[model samples]
Target: MKHALLGASKAAQWINCPPSARLQESVPEDPSEYAEEGTVAHALAEIKLRRRLTLCDSKQRKALDAEYEKIKTNPFYGPEMEQAVQEYVELVEIRVMAAKARSSDAVVLLEEHLDYSDWVEEGFGTGDVVLIADGVLEVIDLKYGKGVPVSAYNNPQPRLYGLGAWAGYNYLYSIDEVYMTIIQPRLDSVSTDIMPIADLLEWAESVVKPAAVLAFAGEGDYCAGDHCRWCKVKGNCRARADENMKALAYEFKDPALMDLEEIGSILFITEQLKVWAKDVEDYASGQAMKGNPIPQWKLVEGRSNRSISDKDAAIAALRATELGTDKFLKPEELLGIGELEKRLGKKEFAALLGTWIVKPPGKPTLAPETDTRPAMNSVENDFANTDMED
Candidate 1:
């Protein structure tokens, strides 16, 4: 799909950075397998949703089925994806039914184009699902990846989509509020946030419009933060390098021991350091590949290991050896809880072996207080452990 320079998907980035949208256009990103898998999952979810909602006529249904069959032929498509997408479809269906209850002419549109150009110049994006009723306009985005948990509260992406939805449908319905949602089936998360129409427009004018004007004209200061993770030019951006250098200066703070404030500061930029270091390495490698090597750096073969050319043939030869198959084979092991769940599915797995399943406490780790997970009580845990021992 063709994307506008100021797309809703990257609203969080450009709105925050203000200068990254045009900077990103210079360095094109290579497509990954994960993105392809997400596309397939979205297609599957859309098909199931259209069928359940009876949004398709007979001819359209047949075409949709054909497209679904074609998607099944892809290596990424599987029952696990189907189950996850089914959950998404059912969730959407529930909302659609609710919308119907309130408004007989409720609209449920999938993969619909949205125009937020009023606030952002030529800014548009595709919404995964859009629900329009008399009072509320809802925009739901499907995130197939499980790497990061996305929230709807004050999230710029869905908010922009909500703006576009409201702009396109306000005449058809008396929309008073906007409902923004994000559904990450892989993470089993459904985040919803409500904002009044007045508030939504207020944000658009005060925040989105000013930043978008700067972004579209490529005339703003370069700011670096979490949003830089999505910027294509991050590896070589001088602003990011300068920020990282400034952030790294804290390392010079007492080497012997650290105070809580110093430790917190270090922790804040730890991930940023790692991401910057890796991106610089990749950038250097790409430059070297193009015969633009660094002055003192030279490329050489990195460490590698040999592997069997044909695993099946190698295994057969190993089995014929006098050393016996024991040398090559290990004892069979049971699948992990997650793998088993995938094979049996959540419902069936729970029904058959829910009693046997147990969840152990995860190792304690440091995180920002903004994290929604409850903080671990180390003192209470130790007391409980002592009591149990006695």
Candidate 2:
């Protein structure tokens, strides 16, 4: 049976550590502001290019700048940066078209979602641009993020996108091979990679299908770790602590004792812990919802005693004295506790201590308890004696 699995990036991690699935599953909706900003930028870029291509004059360029000025005050990004990026993208598109980079006789498919069933049980993806350039199918994805620059080389997402494009075009046009490319307009870099249809299909069949089956089974085979910091079910997992401890131990162990077999075993156990941790986290979350006590702990906020920076006060006090010139304590120098205690008298120092309040750590549980056990023997005897007197 085919089930909706985590995307390519997450699926790759799952092969190494199943606990990472929690992160993949708990992805929240994109921030509205970010979505709006992206839309505005893309729309502006498209408009500018279409205008430049149609008008083909310096006058049109000035008009484009004026249009950009209207939205200059927008908080998403400064107008200058936005305009620069738009211009860069326009230039790249022009260059690619000028060189006839795409095949003259190649089929063109733009902004289409393609599905491939030949590889995995039910594989589907979409490409930003697809064209049969030089008689070979090419799939391209445009990325905006600078933090993680999209690389076409050994990139699974783009490869999957290529597969989808290949599947889509192969039906209508006889395609022999597929090529993938990622253009980062912001970085002014273009990366290209090739994937053979046979290899791509093999990965889907041998790797992706089995992983999808395991994920869909809903078995207690997931684990938790630092990745749980972003997991939705972290609060429910008891195995989180165990997994965290195990990960720590593995990290701290001596490298000298690790053989190939030992390393393999460690990897396997780590994956298992990830699954178990997720299960525990899920179970605990359910318990909490039912008003049951879930075994969990948090760092107790405790106050540590610290000396106040009384440099100004000390300087002022010393300056007030008519000692030859108004020579005061240097701002750079600090008095030790012992020196301060000796200078201020024991009684005065004790009085100063009273001015400081030490806040102790609060007790853990905030819930009120219902008394279910029998009264203490002393309390029972007192109640009995009071009843006799009455």
Which prediction has the highest lDDT against the true structure?
A: 1
Error of 1 at 278 (Å): 2.4
Model 2's C-alpha root-mean-square deviation from the true structure amounts to 22.0
lDDT of 1 by residue, 1-390 (tens): 788999887888899888889888867766889889999999898888888886568899999899899988989887678778888888888888988998998998888899999999999999999999879899999998888788899899999999999989898888999999899987899999999999999999999999999999998988888888777787889999999999877645556778788778788788789999998888889889889988899999999999878999988888787886678987799898888877776777788899999889899998898977999888789899999999
For each candidate, give its TM-score against the true structure.
0.90, 0.49
RMSD of each: 2.8, 22.0
Q: Model 2 off-target regions past 4 Å?
A: 1-74, 80-102, 117-123, 216-244, 250-390
List lDDT for all candidates, in order: 0.88, 0.57
* Model 1 collision count: 0
